[model samples]
Target: MIDTIIFDLGAVLIDWNPHYMYRTLFTDEQEMKDFLATVCTPDWNEEQDAGRPLREGTDILVAQYPQHEAYIRAFYDRWEEMLGEPFHDTVELFRRLKISGKYKIYALTNWSAETFPVALARYDFLSWFDGIVVSGVEKMRKPAPEFYQILLDRYHVDPQNALFIDDNYRNIVAAEKAGIKSIHFTSAGQLEKELEGLKLL
Candidate 1:
């Protein structure tokens, strides 16, 4: 029986999208997309998620792409703008699960440690989790099995009894390899159905 639910914070619970912030920075949609694709790629952002300081990451990129210095600096300087309001449906589910007092709730997210404080301060619901494993603080990011293992080991959680939910397919595959069952999150409505099928809701 699944006694624990591990949540991926970014897409599953919070509305975090770099596009949201960049849209306002660039008047041309194509230009904004190209800038994100070429300059501040997901791979580059992942480094910060893997414990590289935002300043260091931005500095490295700024040095390499000196022409795009302002854009690079905006990444860290206005990081909070990348985040949006919480997904109320998901938050509702989370609160309901917590109220049940039957399952253990935990969070595992690939968020930059430097910018995480802003989220912590902004969202009161974040404190609801029994524990939260942040990749930036741990120096590892998911789809890394070691990242999942850290949560399992630290919490004394049995992978077989845990259900991991993430928006990324790669992370879900890694979780399954680590012995935890996982769901690829699409929407709160879908998640609600999955939990119902599992008899968790």
Candidate 2:
């Protein structure tokens, strides 16, 4: 039986669009794409999600792309806007799961400390979780075995009894390797089906 349900925040509960922020500053589509590619380079957001300070990451980006210094700053300046809105149906699903009292709900997200609180303020649904393990705050990120182990230890949950959901395939694979059953989240409908398949609902 699945005793716990771990959820990914962005792309799962909320609508996050990197293009929204880039579009605000860069009118040219190709230029905006390139800028996004540069800013979200593996080393950049990865480090930030893994607990690197926001200012430090921003400084690195600024140093790398001096031509867009102001724009780079604006990226973090308008960070909240990138989180478009909560998906009401998904929020409702979480609420239902919580109220069912069938499983312990938790949030495991790869988020920067600076951005997490801002998102929490806008989306009250986040408070529903029994535990929230944020990468930046925990200094560990998805796809890392240590991070999942941290959740396991903190919650005192058995890997076989846990179900982790994420939009990223690699994260799901990692969780599976750690002995936690996982689902690559695509949509609320798909998630519902997966839960049903496991007889969680």
Candidate 3:
């Protein structure tokens, strides 16, 4: 039986997309795509998500690609603009789970500690979680077993009794390997069915 629901913040609950912010920065869509692919790629952003200071990460890129310095700085300078409104379907599920008061609710996300404050300030529902394990705070990102262990050890949550929900296949695989049951999130409606099957909803 599942006693806890562990959630991933970004795609699962919050609607976050870098393209929304970048589209406004560049007049040409192709140029924006090129910048995202070559300059500010997901891999580059992951380094910051792994606990590297945003300033250091952005500065390095600014120095390396002097021509794109302004663009590089805009990544963090206009960081808040990248975030979208919460997914209402998921938020409703989260609220229902919280209101049920039968299970512990937690979150595990690969978000930078530096920028998390903004999220905290913006999202009132974030306080609903009993706990949240942030990769940037732990200096370890997912697909790494130690990160899952840290959550288990800290919360004393038995992996077998907890359900981890994430959009990333690799992270879901890692969570399963750590002995936790996981759901590869596609949409909130799909998640509802999964939870219903588990008798959690």
| Residue lDDT tens for model 2, 87-123 | 7777878988999998899998888887888888888
- Stretches of candidate 2 off by over 4 Å are none
Q: What does candidate 1's lDDT look like per residue over 104-172, in tens digits?
A: 999999998888889999999999999999999999999998999999999999999999999999999
- Top of the candidates by lDDT: 1
Ranking by TM-score: 1, 3, 2
Better of 1 and 2 by lDDT: 1
Q: Rate the local accuracy (lDDT) of all candidates.
A: 0.94, 0.86, 0.93
Which structure is stronger by TM-score: 1 or 2?
Answer: 1
Give TM per candidate: 0.98, 0.95, 0.98
lDDT of 2 at 118: 89
Which residue pairs collide, candidate 2? none
Q: Count of backbone clashes for each model? A: 0, 0, 0
Candidate achieving higher lDDT, 2 or 3 = 3
Off by over 4 Å in 1: none
